[model samples]
Target: MNARALGLLLGYGADRLLGDPQRGHPVAGFGTWALACERQLYAPSRTRGTCFVVVTTAPWVGLAVLATHLPASRTLVTAAFTWAALGGRSLEREALPVHELLFEGELEGARQRIRSLVGRDTSALEAPDLARAVVESLAENQSDAVAATLVWGALAGSPGIVLHRCVNTLDAMVGHRSERYADFGWAAARLDDVLNWLPARVSLLATAAVVGATDGTSAARRVLTGASRDGARHPSPNAGPVEAAAAYALGVQLGGLTTYGDRVEDRGQLGDGRPVSVRDIRRAATLTRQVGLVVLGAAVTATAMGGRLRRR
Candidate 1:
């Protein structure tokens, strides 16, 4: 394997084993700095939003570019960047506790724990709604945190990986329909959509492959068919496909009345299967892990093949 592939695989292993560092994570630091920048840069204008994105994200990308250029430390630098960017294990860690809380019949505890995973109002959510929220967040975040990070890393090396993660962070921070962000967050939201476009489809494909391997072709076909039919209907262009695919792959319906703060959204159903229950939470987590492994394998194979072809 070349430096890129080897670094990515090692970083992936590190993530699987150690997960993200508990304190002073690079991503967290970036978010803090970005928030400060946003305080100064926030304006109800798309142009200002564009500038905020460039100002906050460019430095990290440039630093990544510089870091990867050190021949002596190239692999180590790349691995570090990959490890910092990917959050597959952290995503699962945040999600499974909600499952555990539900399994123990602690509805209030589950609701409180789920707040870490979703932005929705969990206080009033019952068991089924809580399960749906966990499943949806898992499916969508699998694409955002795992698929997109790997795809950008494979395509553009360290800088690409950093850039994707930075843009995604900005989107999550301010990308919303609220009055405060509707205009100011346009650039981050659109760029995230563009950056995530391929990754989301890759996520769907990964879901299909994993489901097919585990549950046979019919289930895989359901994932694809459901996504094709209902994916575009959701507000987010990228999230819809992956979430829909995951819903069908797990044989559970998702997307319904979701409350975010005072905003109420009736996201139409995705799959035709039964309403998601507490049990499907673990199933979804397993499916996400399998999908991530599939993505990792594909990324490694592609990077390795490309490396060989370039040599030829």
Candidate 2:
């Protein structure tokens, strides 16, 4: 494999083995910068949001561009980006803790742990309901946080990964529909959706493939079809497919009544199996890891093919 692929592979290993470093997380730093920008630039308009995105993303993009040019810096830069941007380890850390807390019958602990994983209100959730929420978040984010990074890292090395993370960060920070940010966050939300579009579909197939590998199925299409039905109910164009696949794969149902800060959203339903359980939390993390492996494998294959094409 080429340096880029090698770097990504190493980076994946680092994230899997080490998660993220305890201090100086690049995303956290970017978060601070982004919040500051938003404070100074916030308005109920798209123009200001657009400007916020540009201002926040420009520095990272420029540094990535510079990093790509130095042959000596390529491996280190790619590895660094992979470590920082891809969130498989972080996702696992956040996810499995809920299962642990739940398994111990610590509903209060589980609720708090669940909060670390999703934006929804966890205060009143029963054990099963909380498990469903964790599974849903893990599955959806498996695409957004893990698979998408690998995809973008393979496509454009550090620059692609960096920019994608920036977009995703913006969405998490400002893309929600609060009264203060409804219109202002519109652009950020849409950009995140568009960037995530292909990756989310890829995530569905990846999840289905994992299911097929273990279930003795030959055709992915059949599994995908069932998963598709599950995904169709979600409001997000991208999250629906992956979360639906997770629900199907995990033998559980997700989506029902979800509470945020104060509002309750009835997001219909997905899947048709057992109710959520603590085990599904571990299952969801395992599934995301498997998908991450698949994404990395694809990246390696693509890098190898690109090398051959260049020779041709």
Q: What are the per-model C-alpha RMSD values against the true structure? A: 1.0, 1.4
Writing each residue's lDDT as its tens digit, candidate 1 over 1-312 gives: 888988888888899999999998999999999999999998999999999999999999999988887766677877888898889999999999999989999999999988889999988999999999999999999999999988888999999999999999999998898899999999999999999999999999999999899789987888898897888778888888898998889878988778999999877788888999999988999999999999999998999899999999
TM-score, model 1 to reference: 0.98
lDDT, candidates in the order shown: 0.91, 0.84
| Candidate 2, 179-201: lDDT as tens digits | 88788888889989998988888
Q: Which is the leading candidate under lDDT?
A: 1
Off by over 4 Å in 1: none
Off by over 4 Å in 2: none
- Per model, state how many residue pairs clash: 0, 0
Cα-based lDDT at residue 230, candidate 2: 64
Candidate 2: residue pairs that collide = none
Clashing pairs in 1: none
